[model samples]
Target: MSQPPLLLTVGEIARRLDTKVHRIEYVIRSRRIEATGWAGHARVFSEANFDHIASELIRMDADRHPSTRSNG
Candidate 1:
């Protein structure tokens, strides 16, 4: 039998990404990034969600520095 895939909690994801848990929560709220599951009140996410969160952070950074955005 195959085992279930591992899921990461908001805090774990934040630690791995070198960011604050609140930032991840903000991205989830702003970008509507859904959680894969839940641990009581805490939100849990899949690796795929991690990728999306990272992308959103990069976008947010670009938004804060328009000059760094690609012209093409």
Candidate 2:
């Protein structure tokens, strides 16, 4: 429900998601999330990319935690 950043690094995304950076990288490598492009030596993600990843992770969390699931 909040606005996403214009761009972010994997570490920033991981911190925002309360996960580890390695997990973020894993998500990228596994194609769960897509990078927008490169920023210096780091990977960049657009607002759309972050939104997509956040939604996917939420869905994954719902799958892992039944209490978080919706009736619909």
Candidate 3:
């Protein structure tokens, strides 16, 4: 109970992020995010993976829109 989730399923990630399942898979497949390992038969993603994905997205957005960069 203290260890957090071992891994979140694709659907669970989508639910948490309020995005589509395909989007989640795309990030995982493209290596923008990572799946920790397999469990039984499912590809398992760490809770930290969402944080990683969020960071990557922010990086990408800043790269695409330089004007969004903070002046401070």
Candidate 4:
């Protein structure tokens, strides 16, 4: 027998990201965020994959923001 894959529901993801369920749903449906899961109503996200995507998003956000340089 094969073990079930570790997957995260939309609600779980929302809790992790500290966002609302609607926002997560929006991201998933709009394809604004990268994710892998079954098609249709049985969608699920792998914890590893979601972590990777979230990390990338954080990095991208930091890159887009300019660093403040101060003269001593």
Instruction: Decide which is better by lDDT, 2 or 4.
Output: 2
- Could you say which candidate leads in lDDT? 1
Q: Candidate 2's residue-wise lDDT over 1-72, tens digit each? A: 997558999888988989878766766777657678898999899877777777777776777899867788
**Candidate lDDT (C-alpha), each:** 0.90, 0.79, 0.75, 0.67
For TM-score, the strongest prediction is 1
Compared to the true structure, candidate 4 yields what TM-score?
Answer: 0.49
For model 2, where is the 10-residue window of minimal lDDT? 23-32
TM-score of 3: 0.62
* Residue ranges of candidate 3 with Cα displaced over 4 Å: 1-5, 58-72
lDDT by residue (1-72, candidate 1, tens digit) is: 998887899889899889998998999998898889888898789989999998998889898999997789
> Residue 21's C-alpha lDDT in candidate 3?
85
What lDDT does model 1 reach? 0.90
Ranking by TM-score: 1, 2, 3, 4
